[model samples]
Target: MVLAAASHALSYFQAVVIGLLQGVTELFPISSLGHSVVIPKLLGWDSLAKAQSQSESFYLAFLVALHVGTAIALLVYFRKEWYGIIGGFFTSIAKRRIETPDERLAWLLVVATIPAGITGLLLEHELRTVFAKPLAAAVFLMVNGLMLLAGDRYRRRAEVRELVRTHASTESETEVGRRLDTLDFKESVAVGVAQIGALFAGISRSGITMIAGLARGLDHEDAARFSFLLATPIIFGAGLIKLPDLFGHLGNGVRGQSLVGAIAAAVAAYVAVRFLMSFFETRTLWPFGIYCLAFGGLCTLLFI
Candidate 1:
């Protein structure tokens, strides 16, 4: 009873914090959702959890709604692009514009979504059980941070190599511009493969895929667009699977509280998305890397 009360006390704060984290961290190279899990786990969530025993898994429901909150934020923020992408799907073939990059961008989302969907389905139970361990989550958080650093380093290397190549070739500006859209199906697939690692480690789905996209020579903005687009399907799929559980637990005790938390999360996440878009435009990934490093190290110390 004492432990449950403490856990309940933590949930209110965790809601706002995690919502904000979800909003900002989702797009930032450091995984916000990953950090959400890792941070709480580090803070002795698991220990409290074990003391309580046979917990109703209402937290799982809370998490589902939290993602849904962020998903709504993304849809609201990107409504225009989504509208165009959806419209372009049926209209483009009729208009006979030979599969524009927008179309390919739409297709690339599918390419990237597939692997994670399969992987998540295969590993969901294992993840839920194992992710309860804060120390493991902390280690993964460190791994996730290194992955982001490595990605940024690799991207800079590629950009430098491309610049060198361009200087060597005396390439026309037009030709250089042409290279951005040039990533093929194979490269997109490779990025999808990069996404699988995100499931195990708390790497942002956006970060790893964006790295793969950068490696494939997509400019940062385009890579970001691809990353966000890839998220829509994965988010929707996960929500569907988790939604069934939400209702069974509804009104069972924590439902009202969880719903309240969901709304709080949604509102906070909306504001977060508003600011994060602008922030990413001007920022580098280094800050998020630093945050993950510090947070992960703290978690490791606490949990280990």
Candidate 2:
């Protein structure tokens, strides 16, 4: 059965609310999908959450448009990186060798995207069918929180151990620098594989990837950058795949609402990424983890 569109139709208010929520939560380590599902239920807009009709098609399209907005924001914000990747891609083809850091990083991103692409191709529909229940989403959100917390603890301990070793030696702190561009094939592949977890409704794409990066000893800032960069292809691809489905519903006012929602989503996502990049320079993911845990637990208690 198809899901009911938000409030039986894609109202402007619903569009903006869901758009803002998607933009903010999409990158905040909490599950945007979980919020998309739970928020409607909590607001007593159960009709909005039901998979019932062609209107549901519009809603899904609207969500995809929000993702497209988010992807666009990432692209705009990271245009420099994209430029390098593009140039390096061509250069590698022409030269028959990857020589520059950009070229190598481009290849790394390709390696990083492969696993997720494969995973989505193989399991997206299955997972969506099996785990679309709000209770399951809530439960997985808690799991996501626990994963974040555990990852943080593990990284902190690793950092402490590294600090001790550094202090014991003659090297200065400034001398211990990370080169994110120098990630080997193995590390890149690992990060890519870790991205598979995000297919779960409550699992976060950026959060899981950053955790994987931390495991590979990247600092938070660099890890966040890497995660955001890697997110572009997947997010954009998902949106594109859903765009055709939206066309049939465009005449029903879905088009205008989608435009507004996409704009709101883009602006919000740009602001969020800007803040998060600076924030992660010094802050840990603990706060977001705690929030997810509390929110998820509350959702579980109330809904399950």
- Candidate 1: which stretches are off by over 4 Å? 1-14, 42-56, 92-98, 158-181
Whole-model lDDT values for every prediction: 0.63, 0.80
Give the Cα error of residue 77 in candidate 2, in Å: 0.8
In the range 214-242, model 1's lDDT, one tens digit per residue, is 66655455566677777767876787678
Write the residue-wise lDDT of candidate 2 on 1-304 in tens digits.
1233433466788889988988888888887877777788788767556541223445776777899999999999999999999899889989999999899888888999999988987887677656756777788889899989988777666563474344322222332324577577888999999999888888998999988877666667777888998999999999898788666543244777888889989999999999998888778889988988998899999996
C-alpha TM-scores of all predictions: 0.80, 0.89
Best candidate (score: TM-score) = 2
Q: What is the C-alpha RMSD of each candidate to the true structure, in Å?
A: 4.8, 3.9
Lowest-scoring 10 consecutive residues by lDDT in candidate 2? 168-177
- Give the CA lDDT, 0 to 100, for residue 141 in model 2: 88
CA displacement after TM-score superposition, residue 49 of candidate 2 (Å): 2.2
